[model samples]
Target chain A: MSETPDTLVEPALARTPLDALHRELGARLVPFAGYDMPVQYPTGILKEHLHTRSQAGLFDVSHMGQLRLCGRAADAAAAAAALETLVPGDLLGLAPGRMRYTLLLNDGGGILDDLMVTNAGDHLFVVVNAACKHADLAHLQERLGDRVAIEVLADRALLALQGPAAAAVLARFVPAAAAMPFMSYAEARLRGIPVLLTRSGYTGEDGYEISVADDRAETVARLLLAEPEVAPIGLGARDSLRLEAGLCLYGHDIDRTTTPVEAGLSWTLGRRRRSEGGFPGFATIRDHLDHGPTRRRVGLRPDGRAPAREGTGIVDGGGRPLGHVTSGGFGPTVGGPIAMGYVASAGATPDTPVTLVVRGKPLPARVVTLPFVRQNYYRG
Target chain B: MSLIKFTKDHEWIRVEGEVGTVGITNHAQHALGDIVFVELPEIGREVVQGGEAAVVESVKAASEVYAPVDGEVIAVNQALIEEPARVNTDPQGDGWFFRLTIADPAQLEALMDETAYQSHLEDLA
Candidate 1:
């Protein structure tokens, strides 16, 4: 677990794969998920955000957990099917090189963590959120350890090249990466280094997340940054970008107490899994889906300028307590403040008048459709 | 020229006789990533020394700008409402938070001058 830095005695923070490169590039490093991460570069958060939208921004996301589940080539189906017992996503139909965004669930239908599951040719590749990695690995170990091989790739570093021009920048290095569609992954070579390149990202943009050996991380990152269209992005703009895209940040939007249904992630539940009902929390998730969830995660667009931050009380027009703001911030692309939080289902409708109690004052806000900024994923 | 003074909290006051213009120091703005919103105090509002007078919201977090000395708010920066980014660009000038009628001009003696404030920042590091 990462220690919170106090004003006095500072705690030791781990460095990411590209820590030295980040310092050379003028990044303002901050502690995140037990690692010293660049929150923003000298280019600034706003510029990095705008640059990613217009061009491409490369992000070092090595702190996340990368794992592989392996068995015999033909028997890989068994490993994939076994994973279904924990997550509710459809894994049986996952073709080679395909990827799906799914959640790890507890027995009570609460989301343990959200992750990406890919069907590697002979095995399965999984990437989980950093903070929940230890727990997720332990959960899998206690559940399916005897059935399959769970390999932790601690020597791997993950990099996300995101934006409208991300493909163009990456194609210059690996032409094959240009052919992979969204939500697909393949073991490919970039600049002569073997890496797992995936056509997916959290920014709601057409992007590629490259997973390379930790030792070669700097070389890959520098090559990408060398592209005219690519700039080194930091965690600051990453949060803002994902916020505007209506993506959830673990430990904030969704936790062990929040079910996937309540978190607006029911779409990730596979149709077969919903009926087969063998996974953890299957009963509670199905029941909630059958009879609409009592509460829901919805987007909020404040009518005024003041940003209603996390933990701010969300109230109705009459000042009655409705819910609370889970994640809120000013979105540069949306050109206004955007937030997402759980509200009573009745108040979750878009355009519902609500008030965010910011600093004891009732700040006017309204429910808006999620993805405050529209997604630009490459479909073809 | 108005004599400029700074507080330990990183606020600056440009004292021009009985009136003073207040704003956050450049060092403070740099610390607060990007300034996205500014909540100004109401004109004619009474303020106590070192009390909350304004609010500045950055992309990272929100911070309260305090009154360096007891005073009555004579004017608040209206331009900040639409362009709060100005605080990041020119915090000590166009980003000035407010102007107030000094309730106790003698309190100005407690603030640090440019040289003293510069040395204080070094001590902090």
Candidate 2:
């Protein structure tokens, strides 16, 4: 965080393989998760956001951690079962080439992190958030080291080509990408550059997340950008897009203090896992599933243009405290302010009236269903 | 003749007699990105020089627009309520926030003129 004064000596920030490319494109770099990443480009955030919705947008998400886990003697079934011990997902039943979103919980049922686990036929591929990657790596090693051998893919870069036009654009380079089903993964060549492709994205759009070699990252990105339908997007638009998609940002919408059920992520808990109760915090999670949580995460739509920012207080019509906003901002797609926050479960019903205290003033708001905009995943 | 003066905080005031029109400078708007919301002070509210006067929100964050000089607000731009993008399109002309009765003309001397304000922006860059 840049909260420290400029006069004080700041720690050196890590740079991605595309650092020079970002600067060359006139990106305004800022400190994020210990990396100097681009927040916005010359096109600005508002335009970048709208562009990603209507057309294709290329994003550099290389700072996230990517790792591979293989069972001893290269047994993938054993690896999947070993991973099931740490997460609430039914990885053992997960089909090859399919990815499942899961959470890492502490013994107390509090969420430590959320990650995506993909069954790569012979091994398991996982992607974790940048800020929590180091801790996640340590936890995985400590708990499942004996059962699985973890290998960090530090030399790879992740890129996301997202939007309704993403499939068509990617088809020009790799024809198979256009036919891949949602949440499916494959390894293919993009115009001779070997890459891993996941027909999934954070923006709720039908797109692909590509993993390429660090040395070939810029080349692959440039190739994608050269397409007339694609534009370079930055972190600023990435945040708005995910928020509009009703996605949770780690360390914000969820943390060690909140549980998967409380975060409205109970769906990530597989049916078998729920009944078997083997993962960490299974008792508390099962309890929450049996009895509703005291507080629940819900979508909030402020009545006017003014956005209710993070940490803003949520109150009832009578000014009684309920909870505080975790992620809030203007949704360019919605053309108004949108927010997500925790509130008393009793008042979490859709269309329920609520008030947001922004800058000491009460702003009228209402609880609504999430994904303010419709999700356009490529189900076929 | 009207004269324009700027505060170090990027607010600009153009005086034409006792009433001065105030708004954030173009430089400020550029730094803030696209403007989405504007909160102006109530008419007839008295404000001190360098005190919080208005709020301008961009897609990313909100920023306070400080009063360049002590004054009493007389009129506010209602058009901003319907279309805040004016602050980005014409920050110097139609995007003015409010008009205030100058409480002390002497305060103008402390503000930076165009030449000084341009140099100030350069110093920041």
Candidate 3:
């Protein structure tokens, strides 16, 4: 058994083929997503984040959970239906090579996790964070047992190549990669190794996420890094990139305590599913969907350069507490400060003035639309 | 060129006459990761040694940059107000955080010389 304490504690360390490369890059390794991954590099988070937005950045994301679902046609469709019972998306309409983002709901309609499900020709490919993988797998098995074949792709590694020049940079090696449109995926070969490539990323840029066998991951990453456009980006840039993109971080922006509707993710719900109501916690979700929620997620723009980080309390003019910041940072791309938080539904409107209590000082903040920076996804 | 001294907290002070240019070390920037925002002190603000002089935040954590010596802020790096990552890119050069008029030139005794600070970082490694 190759199981060690570090491996057992963080599945990412045990799985990522580029783990050694991260160390070589002088990354400050930390336990994240059940794997020891680099949080930052010697260049620091701000530079890394900006560099990725301006150029191409390579990210080792092998710790994310990858799974394959297989069964007869009807059985697979039934399995999709079963999975849909827990999330809000229309899984039946998901075409082959296409992907959709959705949330896993609890019995109370609260979000358990947000995940991606892709229709791969003969099977469904699902990816989730390492921290939520075990629970998600158990939940899927519990709900759709015996009807579908659930297999964890433990030997595969995932890499996110993101930035403005991602397509141009990746095309040099993987020519077929340039053809994949945003949210679509395809199978290709790199260095004689067959791989799965998808046009998706967490950073607000055009990018591709490649899934390759563990043994060949290092070679592919090195090949990509050899290009002047590609640099190794750590978790720090990854966090800021996603934040600027206005995407939710699993633990911070989403948790068991928040519901899909409250998080502004009701669009993931399929029209047929909304009326059919077959999924878990459908009634609760429908109730919030129809009547609206008491609290909603809002984006905040601090007036000054100071950052209002997570856990910062937000208040009204009279100092009455309103909400707490879930995720906040100085967006390198937007060239200022931005934050996201949960506030009373009444206080959650664009241009609403609020105050962030940071270090015993109330900082001026204005409610703004999410994605402090505009996303530049390559639809074509 | 003047002798550069570093603090255990990672701020650096380079004395030239009665003024000292204060900024975080490259090692400090590397440790803090990506810098998203920097809170600079007002020009002419008087600060005591070891007191909070500024706040630097990265995507992961927020840290206070303490005054290396009792001084009066004479100038601040206004460039960081719009582009904070400049500190991460050129922390020692273009990223000089502030220029302070040293109140007591003798306070430099408490800091580490370049050799000593390099050894300290080596020990950490």
Candidate 4:
């Protein structure tokens, strides 16, 4: 769960294994989640965004926390069930090689973090947001210490190759990976390197997220970059791309005070869990689900050219304060200024006119059904 | 009767007689990334030296464009409204932000020339 950064107070900036490669590509490195990450490359954010939509872009997401959960008795189901207590996902029924997106909710139904859980047969592979990884790992340890062993996968680096032509480029290296459908994963050996390749990504594109050993990260990255369709994308385009997909950035959109239901993520909650109710904050979530949330996340498009930034107020016709924007920027694909914010549920419907108070000036904006653009995930 | 000067804030002023053309330096535009929108000053507005004159937004963030010297707003590049990315591709030539009528010629003395600005950039590194 990455947050839209307004400013930076760089502490001890940690470097990823691909740091040299990023510098070599003339990436503008900035402090993000305690890591010196590439905000953009020489190609610039707009071009990178367009490229990803039409072609492919490679993103180094090694800052994301990768972990493994092993049962004390070699029981994958037992481990998954134990994890179910922390998240609303029905992990106990999840088949191997399939993944489910879940939220780690606090007791009051607030999101602690959103993460992906993949049932890898023997153990569970989980990826959490970079800023929330430490706290998430500690939470897992305190909860499942007796039943399962939580091992942080610090030796692996994560890479995402995303866009329309991603499958063709990736297939050149690992032909088997081309057959993998969306949300499914398999362990594959490519170019003499073993990798865990998942057919999933954040950019609303058909792609794969590859987990490779730290030592061989550059080797795999070079092999992928050698493809004609793939280019190195920075966090700037990544933010814009995810925003166009109506995906929420962790701190900005959904925080400890925001519930998954309010964040428009009730779909992540499993049906069995919705009925049986056994996860953290289950009662509060159930109550919110039964009684519609007072406010909900909605997509906003300003009528003018000015980009409404994070924290811009959402107001009514009379300039009455309604809510605030959580994530706002120029979506290159949308060809206009786009934003996501929480407004009173009354004005959350599509085409509902509202004024976005930006820089003390109220500008015309309207609620739109999310995504703003079409998502092209591969089914086969 | 023309001269070029720079500000520590990364603005450039190209003086031609009583009128001065102003824009962000190429270095400044590069640092800002892709420019998405530009809010220009009105034609009759007066801008004080080092005061905010306009706003330039990029995919990353919004930055206030400060006037390098005191001047009266004369003209703005209307084409920039449709193609703000011009600030990145042609920051020096076609990307010139606004034309202003000089309020006081004395303000130019405090600014840096090309040599001094080049050294200033090196000093920042």
Candidate 5:
């Protein structure tokens, strides 16, 4: 079925620091998360996605929210403990220069947002989805404002240099970046320009997310693009890459209605927090942990070449309703159609047969292990 | 003599006698990005003018290929089932979707000719 175009009148979209640069590179600009962002460049999403997996792809992710969470006394430990009340991760165990992925949950065990929290020595560095940033800020303020100061880093631009060759390409600018272990953070100077570098990315590749001042974002992007191994990637490829990696996209694969356990993100719930039950919806989350969720998100591999898209319904052999696809598209790396959606726990087994209803036709598919493509993180 | 016509929807129909070879214009393919899949109309099925005759899926989304005029599907391009990218590479030539027996030649008058279609594209831009 053809997707309906958004015809609602839009307010003036905000521009990223590299907006002009994206246009100069022949990007097809589109409104995304209230920002005028590049959907794809002249290279197109297919080529851009494959390029990121093989070489390095530079992404302009400045639209996401970045904030500093510090205790009243500027103590990282105190701030981490205060933040722990909001998320299910073990932020107190997050050592200096280390980062952990966690989810902000509502009182009923629903996920508010999934975010990254890094122990930045003096304070906690947090990054949340662009669409949920404002709400997350308000949530943090209303809950922990008195104990922790939430400072929005509005003047910063975030860039991700990701792929198999990302380390080598970044090393030319900051030699030490290549040696940083996965999930490690550092305040480093790239060619004398100070920036925050994190050895992490959304593409499941060895990479770095660099946070730089807005004014220098374009310069830094241009410098990285000058490298033979680096090319500018857009939101189109980013979505496909993350989808193939089995990572969730906010509001699509996950949202306020889904719990971490049902989303197959039980690992994000810290071991200590699992038993202590201090986070919001801890009672419900603990129940889900003790007894598996009624429905669990599983990867779907559609038979044949036709791609099953989001909102496509899934059914069993007898045509009983199972669930609907949350994220589905062509996985260029997997060389076939891949999808992720929730299904009854009885039908969530890998290799179980399921039918995807596409345009009123029952298309054969199977529940498969997530991450159509294997993750290649650099642990060393 | 053979005549080619274009629709405002970016579909093109090349008419020869009672049969018309149909496909999407290059502009439409470029706008849709990479073509990942194509679903052609079933042979011998009747279609109405401006009705959805086929489906072309890009990496990003799926779009309907509307019929330029009334016709009866005669044959489909089976090659696209395995090589949909051909639509992106040669949208108007080898990427022809299907051949149909024209139901009413008068319906073709509403379609834009090459010159008119070029101007129509410019207006859209």
Candidate 6:
């Protein structure tokens, strides 16, 4: 279920009814997925990010992948186990209405994709990146086959209500939503519209991912946004928010050539999986976990206001190249520039000095501890 | 008498008495698409014509605003800082970014008038 963005118009690149709302709000619209989405509003990315941290932000994550995995009790459990074999996360213990973040791994232990898995009744509800959803499903089917049924829930939309005020704003629509614990999923009626509300989000802020039927998604979104605290945030704000929160972007931070361990996500691997060593590419993962990966992901703070964008070469003292920036931008919340990249594990310290070569200039940079801003996620 | 001035970078200046108002023409803001941030010079900062005066960053890119006439920044529209969308809202009215006290009144004659500036925008478009 993919659409070719090459054409002037592709119907599969679906449009949310709120498209008009964005234009009316003077959003800078760009083609993302198959639909036109606002990259940012007039307030700019930096301001939007700071606003989210100080208050709340509404994100139209409708383009995200939403799907359902169904099978008998024993079959579903087997499917979950098979999935767990690929990534370094525990899925078998995921109770219904609980969600866990994990990655899809290739046989070589490289990350194919990172996604969220939620236990919804007898089936597992999965949300992934729109661009990688097709490949992710193929990978799942190739491994699990008919033993577990997979259905691409094309009729659903995902909206991430993020930031400190997210709970307060959402509470007005779904009072029960405020009480749901973090990383847990709950089925609730949002203004009488059936929705899968999960206290999980990419932004480090306390937020919820509300999935609703395509027809009713707009209704629920409009209702939630009616609160004064909610602002129609765009991709630019979302990127900065995640960056400030230190969350990884799949293609940029983690890739098919990078294993989870090398990406500094070994913690996502359950303790049992580490001992059993039964998952695919377990040998390579265990080796990295035991001896440590040669390179690791770390946060970088650039000197001054100039942003060190992705692909910029990162270097050590004397201008010796070390790594490359994956994502870099002016962190609205941090009030400075920040970046993330893979650096030699030896030089990946909290205060290690590095330089980023931007436009033929060696800009001073330093490694800083992650989550540049403290995450305000509400546990409950 | 009021004198109008222009900067090669597309800023316009309209000097009335000792005070001058600086703004980016509708053409400039339209091309930028959704002004998100406007970094204005502090009041009382001295600047010369053709020198860097401020910065305007949009969602897609950033651009430097230039001084159209020699002046001392007397005031800045703080509203734009809190609501940058005003630039897109009214590039010539509520979008006017700052006012300056003319340091060299002679520099005003070098700018483009309404007719000339309109033609300049047409050529670029």
Model 5, span A154-243: residue lDDT tens: 999999999999999999989999999999999999878889999999998899999999999999999999999999999989989999
TM-score of 5: 0.98
Residue pairs that clash (backbone atoms under 3 angstroms), model 1: none
Docking class of 5: medium
Task: Give the better candidate number (1 or 6) by TM-score.
Answer: 1
C-alpha DockQ for predicted model 4 = 0.48
CA lDDT of A61 in candidate 5?
A: 97
What tens digits encode model 2's per-residue C-alpha lDDT throughout A39-124?
A: 88989999999999999999999999999999975547888999888899989888989998999889988988999899889999
Best-first order by DockQ: 5, 4, 2, 1, 3, 6
Clash counts per candidate, in order, are 0, 0, 10, 0, 0, 3
Q: Residue A45 in candidate 1 has what lDDT?
A: 87
Q: Which runs in model 5 stand beyond 4 Å of their true positions?
A: A1-9
Write one digit per residue (lDDT tens) for candidate 5, span B1-125: 99999998899999999999999999988888888989899999999988899999887887898988898999999999999999989988999999999999999999999999999989977
CA shift of A76, model 3, Å: 3.0
TM for every model, in the order presented, reads: 0.97, 0.97, 0.86, 0.97, 0.98, 0.79
Task: Give the local distance difference test score of model 6.
Answer: 0.79
Q: lDDT score, residue A159, model 5? A: 99
Q: Give the per-residue lDDT digits (tens) of candidate 4, residues B23-67.
A: 999888877878899999899899999999988998988888889
Give the Å shift of residue A144 in candidate 5. Answer: 0.8
Candidate 6 chain A lDDT trough over 10 residues, lowest sum: A1-10
lDDT of 1: 0.90
- Model 2, stretches more than 4 Å misplaced? A1-10
Most accurate candidate by DockQ: 5
- State the DockQ of every prediction: 0.42, 0.43, 0.29, 0.48, 0.56, 0.10
lDDT of 3 by residue, A37-98 (tens): 88777776767888899999999999999998776574346557657767878988988888
Each predicted model: what fraction of the native A–B Cα contacts (within 8 Å) does it retain?
Answer: 0.32, 0.34, 0.46, 0.49, 0.46, 0.07
Q: Which stretches of model 6 miss by more than 4 angstroms?
A: A1-13, A74-76, B1-125
**What TM-score does model 4 achieve against the real structure?**
0.97
